[model samples]
Target: MIVGEQKPIAEIKEMVAPYKKLLVLGCGTCVKTCFAGGEDETAVLASAIRLVSRKEGRTIEVEELTVERQCENEFIQEAAEAVGRNDSVLSLACGAGVQAIARRFVTKPVLPGVNTTFIGVLEKQGLFTEECSGCGNCELALFGAVCPVTRCAKKLLNGPCGGSQAGKCEVNPDTDCAWQMIIERLKILGQLDNLRAYVPPKNWNTSTSGGPRKLVREDHII
Candidate 1:
């Protein structure tokens, strides 16, 4: 999931201070799982902003609401209507969701309430680790389902980059070498031949194309 971290309360307040009526928008998906832009965090931020405004002798009106998803147009449209009634909106969703809300509601100014971190997975309870960089190219088949692009520090295609020592990455001794892990995994599965095949470098231009990328679904065509 796309992971994110909340900005400071002071920063959030500063961004929307000019607008007396501000809506604190929360997303109940990725942000919720990461504990950054969830309902509880939104409420706390709203309440804190209210307190700060009051202490500063400024009457700031802040309201909190969590949408099922901010990335969806339907949800964004509903939130847009709610935001239309307010002066501004502080979106507590990921960068994508924040942009979606902004696109759907071009009239109202949307301020981000969190810093979008990365594509990651929950390592354990209350711990999240970055796993993917969304590099556009996928090579899991060549690497035993392990992503060398993201896991390998050097992002080497056919690597264990000479620096790797004792199954650990040279960049960070604490970290395991992604290629090493892949080789070991392939060996265990008797698929060591998979590593013999060379995978080409990723075409980043197509991946990070300027502006939004679109996909068409013939079955879902309206």
Candidate 2:
């Protein structure tokens, strides 16, 4: 899932200070799981803004709403009436969600309330760790499902660089060496010979170097 963190309240205050009628829009999917911009978060933020405005002797009407998702048009459209009634929208979703809302409501100012972090998974309660870089091409089958591209500090294809020590990464002692983990996993799976064949240089063109990507499925298209 896409992981993100909520922006500072101070910064958020400054952004919405100019607007009298503000809408705090939340996403109930990814951001909800991370506790960044879910329904509860949206309400708390709205109340905070109102309290701040009251303390400042100013009146700011804040409304809270949470959609199933902000990235998809169908979910975003559900908030159309609420959005149209607000002076501006404070999006507490991922960067993609914020941009999607902005694109749909071209005339309204869409302010981001969260900083999109990375593609990752929940390691434990309240702890999310990045696991993928979305390089377009997936090479997990070659490395026993451990992605060296994301785990390796050097992004080495055939690694366990010379600096690795005690099964820990050279870049950060706290991090496990990607190659070490890969080798162990391969050994356990009886696929150690897979590393014997040298991997050629990766074709980065398939990645972001090609710019914004799109998937087209003729069979799925209606």
Candidate 3:
């Protein structure tokens, strides 16, 4: 899942400082699951903004609302319609959500209220460790499902670098060596020989390139 966190209260206050009417928007999908831009978080942010505005003697009208999602254009359109009547929107979703809201409603300024963290899974309760860098390349089949691009201190395509010590990464003693984990996993899966296969240099152009990346699903278009 995509993980995110709310921005600092002071930064959020500055973003919507010029707007008199502010709509704090939340996402009920990934952001909700991550507990960053959920309904409760939205309420808290709205209250904080309201308090700050009151203290400043600013006539700011802040309201909170959540949509099923902010990534999709349909849902973003709904949110835009619901909050467009206001002066501006303070999006508590991820960066994508904030952009979506801004793109849909060109008139109102859609300010980001959260910081997009990473593409990861819950490692344990309350711990969301990054797993994927979204490098636009899939190397899981060769590495026994471990992604060295994100897990390794250095984005090494081959085996363990010489920097690893005592199964710990050289970059940080607290973190485990990503290559060690990969080797162990490959040994268990009986795919240790696959490690001998050389991986070509990644084509960064296919990933980030020069501008924003996009994927179009014709079947989904209606």
Candidate 4:
């Protein structure tokens, strides 16, 4: 899932200060799970903005709405009426979501209220850890499913870096050495021979063609 964090109140206050009627749009899928911009969080944010506006002797009307997702046009269409009524939008979705809303409503100013963090997983309750870099090419087969590209502090493909000590990363002692996890996992699977073959560096340019990357499913399109 895509992980994100909400922007500070001060920054959000500044962005919506100009708009008398601002819409605080929330995304209920990815951002909801991570507790960033869900329906409840959206309401809290709207109230906060109202309080701040009131304190400043201003009458700022904040309308709150949460869509299933801001990326999909199906869900994007759900917020059309609310969006149309507002002077500006403060999207509390991921960067993609914010941009999607902007693209759909070309004339409206879509301000990002959340900072898109990364594609990550929830390790436990309230603990989200980044597990993928979306490097376009996947090489998990070589490392027993432990991704060195994203987990390694230095992003070393052929690693262990000689700096890691006691199964922990040298650069960030708190982090487990990705290579150590790989080797241990491979040993368990009896696939230690996987490391014997020398692997080439990642061909990032192959799939990531330098500009905005996208996929069009011709099967789904009309």
Candidate 4 weakest ten by summed lDDT: 205-214
* Candidate 3 structure quality by residue, lDDT tens digits, 63-180: 8899889988877777755686799998988888888888888888889888999999988888888899887767788888989989997789886999998999998898889899
Candidate 2 global CA lDDT score: 0.94
TM-score for model 3? 0.93
**RMSD score of candidate 1 (Å):** 2.0
lDDT of 1 by residue, 1-222 (tens): 999999988788778889989999999999999999999999998999999999999998888899989999877766766798798889999999999988888888999999998899998998887788776667677788878888999888888789988999988888889988999889988999877777776677645653456668999998
Better of 3 and 4 by lDDT: 4
* C-alpha lDDT of all candidate models, in order: 0.87, 0.94, 0.87, 0.93
- Of 1 and 2, which scores higher on lDDT? 2
TM-score of 2: 0.95
Query: Which 10 residues in a row give candidate 1 its minimum summed lDDT?
Result: 205-214
Which candidate gets the maximum TM-score versus the true structure? Answer: 4
Clashing pairs in 2: none
| TM-score of every candidate | 0.90, 0.95, 0.93, 0.96
Worst 10 residues of 3 by lDDT: 202-211
What ordering of candidates by TM-score runs from best to worst?
4, 2, 3, 1
lDDT string for model 2 (1-222, tens) is: 999999988899899989999999999999999999999999999999999889988889999999999999999999999999998999999999999999999999999999999899999999998789999899999999999999999999988799999999989998889999999999999999988979889988778888988989999999
